[model samples]
Target: MTTTSPHPSRTTSPPHLEVTWTDPVTGRKGYVVIDRLVRGVASGGLRMREGCTLDEVRGLAAGMTRKEALHYDPGNRYIPLGGAKGGIDCSPHDPAADAVLGRFLEAVGALLKHHWTTGEDLGLRQDTLDRVLAGLGVESSVEAVYPLLEDPAGARRRLADAFAVDVDGIPLPDLVGGLGVAESALTALDRLGIPRTSARAVVQGFGSMGGATARYLARAGVRVVALVDALGVVANPDGLDVEELLRTRDALGGIDRSRLRPGDTEADGDTWLDVECEVLVPAAVSYCVHPRDQARITARVIAEAANMPVLPEAEAALHARGVLVLPDFVANSATNAWWWWTLFGDIGADATEAERKVRDAMRRLTSDMLVRAENLGITPREAALVVVDRRLAAIEERFGGPGAHAAARREGSRP
Candidate 1:
């Protein structure tokens, strides 16, 4: 079998997981990052890319566990599908990659009796997921299992439903991520003393995450001066017509460059980053703005809509420059929220009720973290550590301490 590179996040040895795949004939490797399997079953997406690794899968799986918390907090107690993420080190263009993916899915499907479900991410597209699931004859999928719950973004439940639905058996919902980003932006805006309605923003990425966020920001009266996709970026000082652009955007988040006049633009794909606006939303892929590009960022508040889109060093640099930095984990709370409601249908109330819950949860999370940062005179990340410490103490008291106090307190409280 072809030897895969070890996960960067892992040491020489860490843990042994049950699910693994390596085809000898083709020499390919596929893996599952089983983060947590609380309710018997574990579910997550399968990413296919040239450099996919076990370590990333591990982290993504764990993130799914936390995401479940945001969604299925109370009524949906048992996070049924323990979180897991699979990865194949084959980019979309490689024929060998597709073969590896199919075989890997079939190989992994052998254990589907364990209630393992899969979704789409990275190089794995919806159609590819279908091919894999179909060949493997896997049923009782995760997307179908996403319980109908209300969404806070007005399109909340549907967002969850849409994300959970395997567009050909591959789920790609990041509404939770988007919501968290908006929350972070809001926090930054409040910090900058800018009203949401008064802020002009630029959005990068036309995928569901970027598209939905841009629409929400516009709805909230944030003028998006520019937007970009894989093909290129676009700008309009008079306020780019989002609707018209969406009409022209391709499925891969492309903007028609045929209508563009060059020279006035900085870069196509990175256009949104250079927009002369108060806020910049990097809702697409990772490292769109690296350290070298940080100086070009015109936005006072850079809200990360994608996971760890900015490098850690760059993030620190941004903070030092007095640009408010919103950590991805804190900003992207929608994962757990969507996961929970999609599983249990929110016994608390209807979709609206469920949405309110998500907002309250996120608002509390962002606000509390920001408040802590302000109070301690530290970055939000540091303040998050404080929040985590207190939460751990609470968990210890409730579940482990001799005088454990897991009792629910009144709304809006700590301890």
Candidate 2:
């Protein structure tokens, strides 16, 4: 069967980035969808889990365009980035998991010649990465890899920091993820006329992205009610202590449920979706919010800090009920901003200048999207795609010619 997606909704969704593998032990199949490789090369982390579909990966690849474009360069606008991603559907305990991941790296590694770099995600851990690297003769530790390619102001490195892994602390407070999320959440709240002093929020994932957002929000005067890691959810309407929780979270981000207790009206999975608050931030795994919990959502604004954390159908349901979604792409733009400045800007400035550039970009993008949504009479999420689509349309023209733009316009216009 021809696997090509029926031409994307727009002419230049950038050919569905592809990489697939079948596990010899488990007999399950998987693929990756990397989109928009801006320079001569590009890279992104791979996700492994159930519901890890190509469609989801496609949406993530689409977000990469918005990410890369945030760093708008005089030349970046004209250069076509080859975006790529990889996806797999298997639990970490599945016997075939190891083999599937190994085969994927071997097959996908072919693109390394073209600047395609891949990292582990979801069910995969640092040990799994060590094993994969050993097999590939990548005789470098995570500690070592950063130094070889590390730069305080480089876009890729800054993005990595936004995920909360600072390199030698040289990139003090370097995190586009938190900056963008805080900016968007603030924008969403401001539109509803919520004062900064009165804002209250909850973060579902206490991992890199979630943790950063919580810290930034707290700094902005928003009282965070809960910060849950993978161990188990915890809440305190009076406000959970961020400092204590970070001390307990393991590197893989699993918290010790044994030593903790959840205070937000104890409920099972998906409980975070219904928490009463002004903003809801899902920064962890995907599909955490589904059909059953869509209606239970009580937050006035939903900000996406993880990659495609909300399903498309679920998003539409929320829209129908009048919930504002700030979009994962728009909220988590710091990663892209950091990388773009590194790749295209005069990166020799002091740390403050780099950070200023990031904040300014976030402020501009989120403010523009929020204002456009109001003016265009569309949801914030829909307005995000409008800005993304317009830039994408302009980039599509640089390829094999003008027909691509026409095709993309028609696809984008689809209902």
Candidate 3:
């Protein structure tokens, strides 16, 4: 399906394609939205949740566009792909969840073959998705982009090797996004004239992203005061044991109470906003911070590790109150960019290389965005959008528009 908007420019245009799939056996619904297509393929992740909708997937796909465009560098080997996202309307804990996912993948096999490349997202695990794909005889969730590779075999090997490499018992792929978040948070703190050693942080999730962010921030001398998960808030005024908490997390990100330290206290999850800290990382769900929630936030900066964590009005309110919101696209873009950088040979499978690239890029991007925001007298999200717009235009000018490749293929010509 396409959008009904009258003014269909690149940014305002409806998705290039949208598919709603219903699992035959379980009757579960799944959605795929391709917001834009660069070189005939779009990239995003597949999320499973209880009430996942097309509109949510569409928003995520659009965010993916901005995330991809925000990382565009003229000299980099990893040209940004278009934006796409898939979501299934079923809880990951449901007994039929895997079957629903398998059926959805089978239904969208054609798109996966050539147009949409995906991986894990909220409520989904990469290993589970990979297992499902393997059972379906699919080579990889990223197989759709293989045709664009200079050396598909080498690219595949590099990504596989990178995924196999673990840092502090966490896989490399899981650490990169949180690494970016930590860098973005640190940059924001630096810009605000705050020292990392003097700052405190409360992260609202203990999953892959939040766990990694807390670990890195603690290592960087930021006192990680609290962590909120499905259970509730785990707090330690003098800084929780981040590595212990990380080691004790379940697959679904819930903390194992058996591992809590004596000084740590548990509280209601909603009290996360009340935590006194210099940085708050909302690394779990989207639209978590509404207008009312904004007033409760005491943090100097909010680094969004989750996509669309803060509502626009809440962000505006926070901005009015001098809270710096490092936008999601700018702050949490490292994971997607890292995947491409490694696959395209801009970086290697080594942890140090990934760390260096993510740190450098995030610092630069956050600094640039903040500077732009100040110059334009706007919020950081607006500034990041401005950057995305300019980069997207440049990408289009050099590579042509979304349909360029398809048009070329139809005319029996190379794109």
Candidate 4:
């Protein structure tokens, strides 16, 4: 473990706990930030990517805190768990990733056992996490259990025996998260009195989340006229074939031009902001939309599927223009699904049931929050934060701050 260093660009207030360390074996650096804790519990995902930094982890951790407070327990029904995030500054493609991950788990063992729970994020796979936990002799609170109500016991048993990991309750990596974004986008459209059949959509990024969302929107009768990837952008007014595009996209969401045709025009990926569409879903890298991009945004509605995809200034600009913006926490179901399953157990007995449960929950929550915000004459983001703050404040008044188990921190760790 090494001492944490200061990053001058970080403008946010200090979190409850922030620590950075490097694995003695693989030399992989990692950061873990606990934004706040409610009744001694804080949780988020572990994301691995090259060039990832402590400041990024800190920002993400704070977003998780807001996500938990607003999306998980908006009504103050249960204790408001703090938000936390972990990041490993290494490529997902690194051969030594497993060793680095194991060391990370070991280093953060105290936090995991006591107050922080972690699952998958951008580059970390659940299967890897499962293996690491098994090797560490740590029991997972959210492991897959079999004998699904919708599946025959004998068949399920045979399948379970054949597979090394249980597949019964495991979510489809892309679908669960994308389904939430699609549902929220539809809710926003409905709130604006726009019908799905008439909505034209542009999806930025063609990876799992973006790919899945584009497919969902197409299926729901929305014309996905554009698909943006790291390599280039493909646009067609008559709507691009999502299935074909998905088959042509690389693992990192780069589209192969060889598979495209004459009718589709290729442009810079960032030009997605200029694509005229009723809906724009940014599921790509964060802060893709800066002030200049915001000024040229042609979409009537922007549904965030990536954390902090729109910078604060751009988001404010969109709001001022009367464009309904669904923040990432509210629109992205990636984190919500895992945390929800962890808290309430399985959604249902089958894939259909699970998907339906997720869709219903996302639609209901988005609708209620948006409608209330409109009635109260406030932006959706503001409304969400206010609701979360109210609940957190109530808990603080009742239990006092830091409720028992005064946060876990290295004795000499700096803020």
Candidate 5:
């Protein structure tokens, strides 16, 4: 279904620019939402999926803006990037998907020149990205292929070999993002006086971020008790075996049903919310935790691995219920990954070292942020916004005092 009207109550100010394009060849539609730009530059992911709507893209773009803006450095120094997101309302299974993506890219080529950079998201893949870029002959026009494309090192080598051009380090968005989320959850638990070793957790997705998050949390001494995906929700009171689940899970986040244990049972989607656990991780989609869903949440903490997984009203309800919510932008960890890669460079030559570096960075950042929020007696979401506003103010000072930035973000000015 098309979104004829935008969500009037956005988490942030309206985006600076919203451009919609219709592919003349396939009659498909695409959109690029630029929430705001830090000195005429912004970056986020590109998601291609059936039923993807403009408002969803707008929300994701705004989340990216907050994620980028929330980078906290000791010296008040960090790479400042604005938030942007692109999406095409189409299925990945369509035979003409490549052509549609190519056409959509071409239509938005002008805006992508240097203003907004995009990476990969939910329904998009690396091979599809390569095909689209090859068709457009605009390889340099792209930025990073993040959450959707994990093997940055291999992708970099392949591109350099094909074009004989130097390629820099490619950031592993999912791995680092997952690591960060796991770290944030543990930090939240610590702040709440919950013992890490005895904490139980339930994850709401089993794809890239969800699966990785489960594994990391398990390793950190948290019992991953349940997992939910498109197929169905599976629960194991004794705690699910994450490693075996990973081995048996399909690319679509479905389990082979045949591999289920006799005690394992399939349940409805909200089964996770009803599971008695100390930590609840919404790692799949936006608006999963609505007002009605709050009554089912038994967990003391909700660490958002997905962007905007909890609606604003739901968050308020969660707060009223004495639940500590680690906001999406803060918990997702993509922000930390971006900050580390852009500032510190490569952590080590191997994956183990890379994970260690991610864990360290996330632990420090999450710990400090959570403690500060607790001391201030404010929600983590409010604390995060304060941090974002501070950074944006710094950018304004550096950019010769913000001119029309305020005007461009007005709702009536969006186009």
Candidate 6:
């Protein structure tokens, strides 16, 4: 892994803790950033990519904080946890990826035991991580929060059942995030008075989030015109066979060209932004959209399925160009919320119930953000920050700030 330094810019409010570990055998670097802690644990996922940096992990951790706080509902049984994130500066496709991940987990075993709860992210999968954790004698990725559960055994059973669920041949956990993204895109279109059937979408990733987003959008009468994977762009002006492509995609989001349909046109990966469409989803990597790439984006709405996919300046540019960006924390929040809702007994492991709850929550949240944006004459990201800040303050006021709980726990633990 590269030893590239983190970006100079830092979050206004510094994270509670940030740790960097270097694997002795592979020399690969891994990072963990706990942005905040609500109660006693924080939640996020671990991602692996060749150029992952501490700064990138920091931004994602902060985003998780907002994502958690945004879903704070007083009536719900599930309370939002704090935000944290882990990242490895190595490609997930590398042969030593699994070994490096295991070593990294072992290095951070103490944090996993008490403070940070994590799961899959960008270049990692849940099953792979679960196998790694099991080897380390860790019961679950989220075992840090077991102390807070009223029924730890029951909660674990519920989460396991939820993970066992399959919706349309895809696991329920994989689809919920994309379902949220799809609902957000659809909600934005409806608010703009555009008929769903007339909308064309170009998705920039073919992984779990993008695949499910394309699937749901296509099912809802939207034309999925193109899908951009690691290799190149698979496009069709009349709409491609999303299901066929989805079936042929590899774990790393590379599409199998041999399975392409007759009408599908393959193009250079760089031309993904050139494909004309009403909706564009950047579900692949962070900082993919810069100001230079902003001019070529024809989509009226960009739903973020990947964390921090758009650069700040580029988002500002897009807002100036009248492009509504459904911010990542708001758009892709359903997966995190769904896990807690199911584990906390707010909902069951049933697919239909999960869909209904996720759809309803995303619709309401997206609508609120858009309305606030319109009323305040601000960008959706700004509107969402406003909502997040308000909710976070309320939560802190009710349960005390993150530090208070940590201090109380420490005090109680000591003789």
TM-score winner: 3
> Candidate 2, residues 1-415: lDDT per residue as tens digits?
1223311224354543566566666666677665654423344556677667776666565566565544444443113244455677777666667777777666655564344545555566545766876798763222211212324235345444443434333133334466678777877787888886777788987765677677677777887876666645676676666655555766655555554545643345446665677888998876677766788888778888877677667778888887888776678867545543443334423455556766676778878888888888777776776766776556544433433433332332111
lDDT, model 5 = 0.71
lDDT of each: 0.57, 0.61, 0.89, 0.71, 0.71, 0.88
Cα misplacement distance, residue 283 of candidate 2 (Å): 1.3
Candidate 1: segments with Cα more than 4 A from true spot: 1-20, 23-28, 36-43, 65-83, 93-98, 110-117, 125-131, 143-180, 257-266, 270-272, 347-357, 385-415
Name model 6 segments beyond 4 Å from true: 1-12, 406-415
Worst 10 residues of 3 by lDDT: 1-10
What's model 6's overall lDDT?
0.88
Over 4 Å off, model 4 = 1-14, 25-28, 72-80, 132-173, 247-262, 394-401, 404-415
For residues 50-156, write the lDDT of model 5, one tens digit per residue.
88888888878777777776663434223546788899998877898878888888888877765776766777765567667777777643433221124545445
* Best-first order by TM-score: 3, 6, 5, 4, 2, 1
- How far residue 272's Cα lies from its native spot in candidate 6, in Å, is 0.5
Q: What tens digits encode model 6's per-residue C-alpha lDDT throughout 1-415?
A: 2212122112237788999999999888999999888877899999999988898898888888889999999888788888899999999889999999999999999999999999999999999999999999998999887776778799899999999998767788988999999999999999888899999999999899999999999999999999999888999999988887777788777888999878889999999999999999999888889889999999999999988888878888999999999999999999999999998889988999999999999999999999999999989988888888888888778677655786534443121
**TM-score preference between candidates 1 and 2, better one:** 2
User: What local lDDT score does residue 126 receive in model 4, on the 0 to 100 scale?
Assistant: 62
Error of 2 at 145 (Å): 16
- Per lDDT, the best of the predicted structures is 3
Kindly list the per-residue Cα lDDT of model 3 for residues 1-415, writing each as its tens digit: 5543211224656788899998888788899999888888899999999988888888888888888999988888888988899999999999988888899999999999988999999999899999999999999999988878878899999999999999888899989999999999999999999999999999999888898899899999999999999978999989999998788789888999999889999999999999999999999998799998888888999999998889888988999999999988788889999999999889999999999999999999999999889888988887888888888888788778655776632432123
Tally clashing residue pairs in candidate 2: 22
- What is the overall TM-score of model 6 with all chains considered together? 0.95
